[model samples]
Target chain A: TQLLEQSPQFLSIQEGENLTVYCNSSSVFSSLQWYRQEPGEGPVLLVTVVTGGEVKKLKRLTFQFGDARKDSSLHITAAQPGDTGLYLCAGGGVNAGGTSYGKLTFGQGTILTVHP
Target chain B: NAGVTQTPKFRILKIGQSMTLQCTQDMNHNYMYWYRQDPGMGLKLIYYSVGAGITDKGEVPNGYNVSRSTTEDFPLRLELAAPSQTSVYFCASSYSASGRAYEQYFGPGTRLTVT
Candidate 1:
């Protein structure tokens, strides 16, 4: 089974602080996605990184896929209260036979709380 | 567009009861999925349908069943509700030219509590 492990399961910080969350895995993936979920709601897609070593930025958030495709990270600059949410990383890959489209295997998740 | 919509935003069930969570989309997406998220845990896929009349089990499909009788609807059935089944359920849909590089759009989610 492919598993993604996220560090700092819980994070609390004041506004304007910077932080980074990491997602690591032993198995390689074809692509990785980052999502942010608020309480009582489903996750909202933040970014998808396909190629290894690729970096994508959305406003103050930056996402990077590891060169090996087995890990990824999300960094926030000058975080605000709106950035407080559960951050999740999901790894995607094809099945053994390669005949079917791949599914996502997600990490446990990182809950960030930014106090203004 | 409405994106993805799930019914029964909240439900409470006793043991041995049965319930169905309804999900629908208007995007004409060929891929639809059912996932459950427990406290402090990421979402786990329970079932997915590639298209109408085709469905497959996902990681956590033990106590759940799903059917896609139409292109826009995928409903998840829980036979014999148990305490372990209590969680937030999400419905997602996606579309891709080759079905390889696609991103999923998610619904608001349904919260289920089983006693």
Candidate 2:
């Protein structure tokens, strides 16, 4: 079983502060995805990192995939109240049958609370 | 388009009771998934369907069953509800294509309380 461990199960920060969430795993993954979920709502995809050592940026959010594909991180710059939510990281890999598109194994999740 | 829709936003079930959670997607996606989120825990895959008439077990498929009879609908069934089954359920859909990645669109969510 693939397990992704996330740090800082809970985080609270004031507006304009920066924060980073980490997702580490012992197993390698073919791809990693980040999601943000709001109360009473399902998670929404924020980004997908397929290549090792890959980095992608969305506005003030930056995502990085580890060189060994065993870890990933989400960094929020100038965090705001709107960025507060449950952030999750999911890792995906192929089965022995070579079926690459499989269900993801998610991390424990990080709950971010930003106050303005 | 209503990317994904789940009916009966909330439900409460007693032990041994059975219920079906309805899910529908209008985007004609071939990949549909059912997941459950426990308190302070990340979502766990319950079941998934690659296409109509094709369903498979996921990470946590115990006590859950799913069916995909049409491209637009995939419903999950829980029989003999248990308190351990209480959680927020989400339905999601994504397009399936070789070498192409698609983001999944999720429904609001269904909060089920089992007593």
Candidate 3:
């Protein structure tokens, strides 16, 4: 079974502080996705990184894919209270067509709290 | 386009009871998925349908069944509800192309409690 492990299960920081969450796995994935979820709501997709060593920035957030496709990371600079939420990393399982089009396995998630 | 929608935002069931969770999408997505999220844990796939009339088991498919009779609908049926089955359920849909994975749109989610 392919498993994704996230570090620092819980994080609390003051507003404007920077933080990084890591998602690691021994298995290589075709693609990786990052999501942020608020309480009582379904997770919203933040970004998707498919190529190795790919980096994508969304406003104050930065996401990176490992060169080997076995890990990923999310970094937030100058985090605001609104940025506090559950961050999840999901590894996309490639199908027969070699695309990460089918099922996706998720990590336990990192709960981030940004206090003002 | 309404994206994805799930019925019964909240529900409570007793052991041995049965119920069906309804999911629908208006985007005409070809891939639909059902997942369950326990408290403090990541979501686990329960079942998925590639297209109408085609379904497949996911990581945690036990005690659950699904059917896709039409392109817009995918319903999950739970038989003999147990305590372990209590969790928040989410429905998602996506469209896949040749060699690229499409983004999945998710529903608000349904919270179910089996006592």
Per-residue alpha-carbon lDDT of candidate 3 for residues A37-76, written as tens digits (9 for 90 to 100)? 9999898989988899999999999999999999999999
List, residue by residue over B1-115, the lDDT tens digit for candidate 3. Answer: 7889899999999999999999999998888999999866899999999889999999899999999999999999999999999999999998754354456778999999999
Among all windows of 10 consecutive residues in model 3 chain B, the one with the lowest summed lDDT is B95-104
Compared with the true structure, what per-residue lDDT tens digits does model 2 show for residues A1-116? 88999998999999999999999999998788899999999889999888899999999999999999999999999999999899999887744454644577889899999999
The CAPRI-style docking tier of model 1 reads medium
Q: Which ten residues in a row have the lowest lDDT in candidate 1 chain B?
A: B94-103
Model 1 C-alpha lDDT per residue in residues A1-116, reported as the tens digit of each score: 88999988999999999999999999988788999998888788899888889999999999999999999999999999999999999987853454445578889999999999
Ranking by TM-score: 3, 1, 2
True contacts kept of 1: 0.51
**RMSD from true fold, candidate 2:** 1.6
For model 1, the superposed segments whose C-alpha errors exceed 4 Å read A95-102, B97-99
Docking class of 2: medium
On TM-score, the leading prediction is 3
